[model samples]
Target: MDLNLESLGFTKEELQERVIARICTQLLDGVGYDEDDNEFTTASQFHRQMRTSIKEKIEATINAIAEREVLPNVASYIENLTLQETNRWGEKTGEKVTFIEYLTRRAEAYMQEKVNFDGKSKEENGNGYSWSGTQTRITHLVHQHLHYSIENAMKDAMKIANSAIATGIQETVKTKLAEISTTLKVGVTSK
Candidate 1:
């Protein structure tokens, strides 16, 4: 079912579209995908690719919903989501914060603002961390990308990118389709 933002106090449609487009685009860019690839050249061919993406996103979203919305015991490490938590020693105050909470705040910050397309932050973009026209969140994205290498003792980042993009597409499509379904069912009743 389509989630109703109106019920949640969001009244703008274009903003919603922009949010969707932005997130989807970010997810697409995160995993090293190119929307202009010639492999999906024709309209129908492109649509088929989109369908595949939608299916993958659906499965991811369903899995997420089931795990998050139903079962609370499972860990909240979303495959498509990039979470970054950190702990640092203070110079003098000696205060500390947990890494998990820090990462959650980062994710929250991302959701509250528009991510630049350069893939790097305003601080790191100019330092060559990423190229132009790439989405922001490069740090977390790259961290996740590199995790597989560290976890499995590999040296490649492409595999992680591919998996992230695949999962992101799957989750995004599923969430959007569910929202649409809810909207379509507003007045319908089973007889």
Candidate 2:
């Protein structure tokens, strides 16, 4: 499937920038003190530091998703598909060809103009080996499955990131308001 991110009113780059900005703002808002135990004095300085931290975090998240989610999902799908195809071939041919050999042979035939299997040429195999029918169906199924998996993975990542930012913002706001209320109470008592 062709994914036109622009249809969502933002390009990938724009989405990345927005996410970075939002996460940085939330992180900066949560910052109560510096290394010297002094409260953050400058919004600009806090934002700069938060931007760097958020960028590193975004990179880490990307790496984690690629390693933990996308790769594993694709590998699992490929494995299952290969097994299904092997079983189908076995049932059709009534030959006990090893799965690995079957895959290798299929790959080789795909690279050639004509597919020859079980001593039968493409013509002898009817339209089974043609690119229009079975081959097209298998290709379409794999494409659709992979596309859905990847889209879901991306949505999950975005949801997690957004949730973290929102939580940080809420916590920061509560802490700052409590501090202000305490300061006001002390001033009133002193007067």
Candidate 3:
């Protein structure tokens, strides 16, 4: 079919060059594949490029789908919580608590539970690392505050004891002096 090339914006010379390339070296004895070796080379290059492009696109699509669909499920599973809200004593309370509220209750319980400072008990029963907000831990507050208070209290106790002892000694001395004066007066009268 003699089709005009001007309609397709192509020149006759360009079409002739393609035709000449196709006519080389291939004898179609029984459907010979290569007109030239360039076809196979071009196909191999196209196959590599197509495989790379498809693999990248497929991986990107899978990642996007996972982010959209699976991540929320994973997050929900991690936060697995009761449908109804409960108080510290496991009784049904007002409204349902969210995950943050649940965690806060747990944190409060952990902090409120009397922290045993007994080193022996800790050595006997300790497990994994313990964590607490520094402000919540009494150990931190006590050490920071009461450590100096103990020394001050001891000093006050010692001062009170010393004052009591001094008062007792003064009273005893006065009593003894009064008894001696009375004995001298009695002896002087007898003389």
Which of the numbered candidates is closest to the native, going by highest TM-score?
Answer: 3
Choose 1 or 2, whichever is better by TM-score. 2
Itemize residue pairs with steric clashes in candidate 2.
Answer: none
* Model 2 clashes, total count: 0
Query: Could you tell me how far off, in angstroms, the CA of residue 72 lies in candidate 2 after the best superposition?
Result: 42
- lDDT tens digits, residue span 1-191, model 2: 56687877898999999878756544666544556757653457667777778889999999998998888797556555533333544654345555566788787655443323233345656766452222433454566688899999999999999999999999999999999998884434553
Lowest lDDT 10-residue stretch of candidate 1:
37-46
lDDT for every model?
0.61, 0.67, 0.65
lDDT of 3 at 91: 98
Task: Give me the runs in candidate 2 sitting further than 4 Å from their true place.
Answer: 1-135, 185-191
Task: Indicate the worst ten consecutive residues by lDDT in candidate 3.
Answer: 24-33
Clashing pairs in 3: none
Model 3 misplacement above 4 A: 1-52, 65-96, 118-124, 127-191
Q: Locate the minimum summed-lDDT window of 10 residues in model 2.
A: 112-121
Over all chains combined, what TM-score does candidate 2 have? 0.26
